[model samples]
Target: MERTTDPVDETPLTAEEYEAVHAAVAAAAGSRSRSLNSLFADWKDVVEDVEEGYSLCAPEFDDDLACRDALGRAWPLLPPRVRAIRRPELDELDGRFRAATVPWPGRPEEPHQWWRYRIPLVVEAEAGLPRPGGWPLGWEVLPFPKPAGVRVVEWGRP
Candidate 1:
C-alpha cells in the first residue's frame, strides 16, 4: 500500500525531487556495499529531501519507530517534493539494524573469549567498524555459554 503524508504548504513534491533523494541514499549505501535496511531503508528518500534542503520522515511499526521518531522531527524543513517512505511490514528491520550496528563474530562452535584489545583488532577490523572503549566491544571469540547474560560490572579501586 502506498502511504503518503499530509500536504505541506499546499505544495506536493516533484518527481525530480524524489529521484534526487533516492539517488543520494543509494549512493551512500552502495558505496558501503550495503542495501538500505528497515531502520535506514528510507535513507535514500530522506537524502533526496536533504539534498532539496529539508528533512522528512516516514513512520514504522517496530523498533525502527524509535529511529523514525528521532529522524522525523526535521521533516518539516525538508525541500519540496520530498516524501517519506513508510516502514516495511516484515519487522525484520530491527534485526537488520542490530546486525548492522553490532556484528556477531567468530564461529559459534568455537570457544569464544574477547578482551577489549582483541575485539578491536579482530572482529572490529573485519567488520570495518570503529574501536569502542569501556567494554570488550561486545565481541565473542567463542560461543556464548549457556545461561550466560550481561549485567552491570563495576570497576574501581576501593
Candidate 2:
C-alpha cells in the first residue's frame, strides 16, 4: 500500500519507516494486550521522536467485522456522492453482459480485475462505503467513471 499523509500531522512516511514504527510499537507493548489508545500513543511517541511531522494512520484490520466497524465509523466523513458497490460476479449474466459491452482492448485479463464487472446497485453517500478488507486486497473504494449502466439503487445514508 502507498504511504498516505499522516492524519495527525499531514506528513507522509516512507513504507519502510512506517513498518519500522509499527515494529517498535509492538516491541514496546510486549504481550500485555494493550488497548488501541495505548498502542497509538506508543506509535505517536516513536514517530515524534524520529520524524517531527508524522503520526501513524489507522491500523490495518485483521477481520471482516473489524473492517466493517471501521467503515461504519468513517462513513459519515466521506465526501458527497461517494458510492459503495458490492463486487459483481463475472459469471453472472449482468457481469457477462457488462464485460461484453464495455470496450477495453488493453484491459488485463486477471482475477483481480473482477471490479471490471458492471456494478448494478450503487449506494451513494458519505459513509458505509465498502473496502477491500480481506486477503488479496481489492478496491478500497470504487474508482470514477463508474460502469456505464449502473443504477442509483439507493441514495443517502441508511
Compared with the true structure, all predictions reach lDDT values of: 0.31, 0.30
Expressed as tens digits, the lDDT of each residue in 1-158 for candidate 1 is 23345444245447775555445444433432332243254633332332332211112112223334333433333333343343332224333433222222442322221111011111111223332332222322224421122221222325
Alpha-carbon runs more than 4 Å astray in model 1: 1-5, 9-12, 31-138, 141-158
lDDT of 2 at 40: 32
The weakest ten consecutive residues by lDDT in model 2 span: 81-90
Clashes of each: 9, 1
Once fitted onto the true fold, the runs of candidate 2 whose alpha carbons sit more than 4 angstroms away are 1-106, 112-120, 124-143, 156-158
Top candidate on TM-score is 1
lDDT of 1 at 29: 33
Residue 80, candidate 2: C-alpha displacement in angstroms? 47
Q: Compared with the true structure, what per-residue lDDT tens digits does model 2 show for residues 28-128?
A: 44433433234334433332322221111112211212322322333333222121111111123224334333323345554433323223232222334
Clashing pairs in 1: 13-81, 21-48, 54-78, 54-79, 55-75, 55-78, 111-142, 112-141, 112-142
- TM-score against native, each model: 0.25, 0.19
Error of 1 at 22 (Å): 2.6
